[model samples]
Target: MGEEAAHRVHSRLDVLLAERGMTLVELSEKVGLSVVNLSVLKNDRAKAIRFSTLTAICDALGCAVGELLEVQGEP
Candidate 1:
């Protein structure tokens, strides 16, 4: 088999929120989640997210999943 490639992905919430002139508290309220939960997501510490939650975040932020998360090739 060919060598497997490894990649890492990071969150763009901080940047996107800044661009939109929003704060984590606002996002949390809009997304119907707690600040702590949103912080986890914003800091890339979340392991899983519900589809409904994802949809809510997308709706609130006016962004798609692709715009929020990006892939980084192995260093």
Candidate 2:
């Protein structure tokens, strides 16, 4: 079997939130996700995210998935 690729994915949730003048609590209410879960994502510590959650966040923030997540350069 081939080994999976190693890549670091980071979230721009904080930036987007700031740009939109929205708080994490507001986003949580809109997306129905807890602040702790969103914080993990915002801090780029989350290992996984559900498609539904992604869609909800995008919808709530009026951003595309590409705008929310970015792949970090090789380290």
Candidate 3:
């Protein structure tokens, strides 16, 4: 029950973008984030995300933080 029990964050950006018919490039331009950064988030490789960045993405995608991120347990 140490850091091992810490929740892992999972990103659902791909599904969300698909639902909105948006591409990563489009999202990047709209949210002012680089495609590489967005790709990291999309592929679940991002170690962390800034609150402002998350807010911007949410605003541009018309989604909530919960919709883009979810907590999961390590297997």
**Which candidate's lDDT is highest?**
2
Q: What digit string (tens of lDDT, one per residue) describes model 3 on residues 1-75?
A: 564356388899999999999999999999888999999999888878999999999999999999999988655
Q: Which has the better TM-score: candidate 1, or candidate 2?
A: 2
In model 2, pairs of residues that clash are none
Listed per candidate, the RMSD to the true structure in angstroms reads 4.1, 3.3, 2.6
On TM-score, the leading prediction is: 2
| TM-score of structure candidate 3 | 0.87
Error in Å for residue 35 of model 3: 0.3
User: Sorted on lDDT, highest at the top, how do the candidates line up?
Assistant: 2, 3, 1
Candidate 2 at residue 67, lDDT?
100
**Lowest summed lDDT over 10 consecutive residues: which window, candidate 1?**
1-10
Better model by TM-score: candidate 2 vs candidate 3:
2
> Where does candidate 3 have its weakest 10-residue lDDT segment?
1-10
Q: How big is the positional error of residue 65 in model 2, measured in Å on the Cα after superposition? A: 0.3
lDDT score for residue 22 of model 1? 96
- Estimate every model's Cα lDDT from 0 to 1: 0.83, 0.93, 0.91
Model 1 lDDT tens row, 1-75: 332333256778899999999999999988889999988888877767888988898899999998888877656
